[model samples]
Target: MPAVTVDNILTLPRIETPALTAVDRPVRTVTTAPTGYEGEGFPVHRAFAGIDMGALDPFIHMDQMGEINYAPGEPKGTPWHPHRGFETVTYMIDGIMEHQDSNGGGGTIGGGDTQWMTAGGGILHIETPPEHLVMSGGLFHGVQLWVNLPRSDKMAAPRYQDITGNKVALLSSQDGGALVRVIAGEVAAHQGPGSTYTPIALSHTTIAPGASLTLPWNPEYNALVYVLAGQGTVGVERRPIRSGQTVVFGKGDTLTVAAADTQDSRSQSLEVFVMGGKPLREPVAMAGPFVMNTRAEVIEAFEDFQAGRLGSIPAAHESL
Candidate 1:
């Protein structure tokens, strides 16, 4: 794939104001699933559909990358690729990943930072560990998620939102035992910096031992919790969950995550990402990198990509 050129650089668009609503949601434990893989590349866990595909509609895939050391000259990142009909969110927890897209957009996201890219119509792009890290060797850790687009907005122009970690709203519990970094949607009165095409909430939460919080969530959306570290219980049933597991919650408006208060010295802080979105529940047609509503639309994506209809990342540009 061609490197994104400096020409036609896209300006950052304004985020639409969110209509915040209050609801008293009931909390309950749902189901839990284990991670499938831990490897050398970007993705260490895959939970595309631990439940049913329809159970997590509008959010097709979830991947946790890194928390590994990449030695100098080792294979470390994804090369050029194409994506259509959805959005990709990359949230960095430890290191930096440089990205370039055909829309003359490219940048680096470091620890406590996020990049949300909408591959609406089509786009070819490359995401990799920064050259310095690849050459010098370093620790890389982060998460990436694929959010599906509704058929109605499948052909919208591609856009990117590169939000620094500081830009993400961080809310703390009354006791200061827990903190939530809202990436999208609303958490209490604090809203995320993300401009989402769908009504969704994505948050990274950390709770100290003995701390707990019950957060209000939209009832219409399906809720998911992926444990990033330590051990904890969720919902009213108090389902026990540990690192490398994902919990799928049934309908309700609120979620409770508690950090275990144990005498064991080895007990660690509990950190998790809680995400939920209203299901599109629409027909889905998917190929390798392209996802469309129909098989024919998928074919059209490939054809357009081949003909350069989507756009091209220039080969020589250094940054956007």
Candidate 2:
């Protein structure tokens, strides 16, 4: 049985994965960080590597990579904000994040932890980097994915998934991990947190030098790839996809990958995050820090915030 409750979050049933279709070439050179980025605290580098999610739908954005540093009592973090009609999935590589949301769901995710926050109709929340990076180099590195919600669930109740590494089952082999289960999409032997809301498959892996892995693709949903660690070549029909890049796939059943670097993964695993869903295909009007489907809606969201209607959010020093 699926993990469903009074929450009404239904995940698509799992099915058999098909064989990967090869492309003409491999992933080529592309812009890694497109959107402007800002660094807070003592981060090594803080910047965006793709289009601001406020635009794209179904697959809004993939934060190629982030390096979060720490400094005690600096209070370096984003303040309370509101998000409507979308979800935020944060996967951390190093360090922890203390998250608190208005939906009564929040927690601190340590290294290898995953946090999925669905800001259905509207959610007020804040995230702060752990104080560890402040002294002993509490560093933070990870990806923040933005997935657009369908009209039906746009205003639904907000929810969260505190996925720990221990809770997640890893499928590997002699070469390296075959799959690092993110939110396994009905796939067997792979299960990540937050599968109840979105039928999504998220994974982080290290394909050894000259290693190759063919992954399944969902034609019903849009597809994209974000490379984090060493350089690589996506086979069948991609260019030289290197670290810090995002790929907009055309159409296919499976994705084939070959390590671009033959000198072993010194940099790290072939870290990547793939996500897709039914498109919202509606007018998107965004302002300073909020995203809405239309201009009027955006105006109303700001108005609500000014009138103290956004809702209570967590803070670095405030009580939850």
Candidate 2 lDDT, tens digit per residue, 1-320?
Answer: 00111121123233234433333223333456554443343332212344444323555555533554444554355567777767888777776677888777888876677888888767787777655644455455776777666656766787887877666545543344334344545323455556644455566654555666666555554455666666676756536766666665555565666665453334544555555454457566667545667788778877877776766654544653
Worst 10 contiguous positions by lDDT, candidate 2: 1-10
lDDT of 2: 0.58
Q: Which ten residues in a row have the lowest lDDT in candidate 1?
A: 1-10
- How do the predictions measure up, each by TM-score? 0.85, 0.78
lDDT tens digits by residue: candidate 1, 1-320? 01111121223222222234433334333444444443335547665544677877878787787466777765377766789999999888877788889887779988888889999999878887777787888777788988999888898899999988778776766666667788998875568999999788899887778777777777788888888777878876777887777777777667778888852343357878889999998999989888899999999999998988877767674343
- Candidate 1 off by > 4 Å: 1-40, 262-267, 317-320
- For every candidate structure, what is the RMSD over all alpha carbons to the true structure, in angstroms? 8.0, 7.0
